[model samples]
Target: MFRRRASVVLLALLLAGPVIASPPAIDPAARNPPPTIALSHFDRFELQPVTLAPGLETHKGNVVARQYLDVDVGERVPRLIEPRNATPVQGEPRTLLIQPEVADIRFITGGKRVLFGGFAGSSWALVKLRLVDKATGEVVAEPQFLQHANSIAAGYSLGAADKLMLARLADMVASYLKTNFDAPVGSAVAAAAPPMD
Candidate 1:
């Protein structure tokens, strides 16, 4: 009887063993780079507002005829990848070129001056930028971002509007960068016994 009970106890212990073990956790955002590509975290930067040009006052009454703006999409990807055993990178000095198409303009803010009746014509411009993978000497991704039908407000221009635009656009570009640059994080471990949903 004693021997039989001991044997059953051992069997029960074996059957219950795996139920108590836990699976490993993984971060959803980590990506493992391909062998040829070295992945790195994104660098941070500050937004320095450009001082309104003196010519802007002269530009008003002329009307914002058109604007050509270029936002490169792929420039943001490297920041999403968290490279293993690598030091954080510093934000590079850079500029965002904004060429505007203006029409029906009455004023230009920032110069503390105004133009009442200058040349009134419509203008627009499109821009292209290249973002390179320095190590591979290749362009990883380049997406063109655009905003059409922009209404130029030369009179009492809201500085806040520009700030808001920058913040929103930067966020949009950043998300695109993260999606393209990083790989989906994988689970490093397997559950001893996966539970059925």
Candidate 2:
């Protein structure tokens, strides 16, 4: 009888061991976090044409005007990415280019200037940008939308406002990539985890 009871107790302990000793359920968000692409992994940066805006025709006769906007925005990307260990190469590895599409844009020309019709009031520009892997043509991350506006009260000329708008667009792209794609390891995982009860 003593032997039988001991055997029964041993069997019960064995069955309960796994149940009691099991680890706490891990947060699923922590287990499967968003993907991050290191900037160092990419070889270079490319800025594509501004697609989806109505006034690109304004650049029809002026090569300089088009180039000015493109160069200004293009140059800003490398300066922003390099500090984070990414180099902007003209060729090599795989170029990660930003494809910008204009979502919305408005130019509030108030009145003609005293001499010529200078832009009077304000201008608005909204752009959406996404990262594409030049090699695979795959969009590696979510699209980012950003907007900027300049008012006459702020004393910004139309040209200056346009430049400012381009700057803001570059800023948005750089800021988003830095925060999402270049986040420190484990930081994203920790961020996804739920609070402890």
Top candidate on lDDT is 2
Report the error of model 2 at residue 97, Å: 2.5
Question: 1-197, model 1: which lDDT tens digit per residue?
Answer: 99986775565434322222121233434332321221223233222221223443344322221120112222322243223214453565222221212211222122221221111111112111233444434543333322211223322343223222333333344443334334422211111111111
TM-score of each: 0.31, 0.49
Backbone clash count, each prediction separately: 23, 0
Candidate 1 residue 145 Cα shift, in angstroms, is 1.2
lDDT of 2 by residue, 1-197 (tens): 99986775565434322222122233424422222475446766676675655644453312333344456556655565555435345655676777766544443322221212222333444455667788898766544343334444323353555455555555555555555555523222112122111
How much lDDT does each candidate structure score? 0.28, 0.47
> How well does candidate 2 match the true structure in TM-score terms?
0.49
Query: Where in model 1 is the C-alpha error above 4 Å?
Result: 1-129, 148-157, 183-197
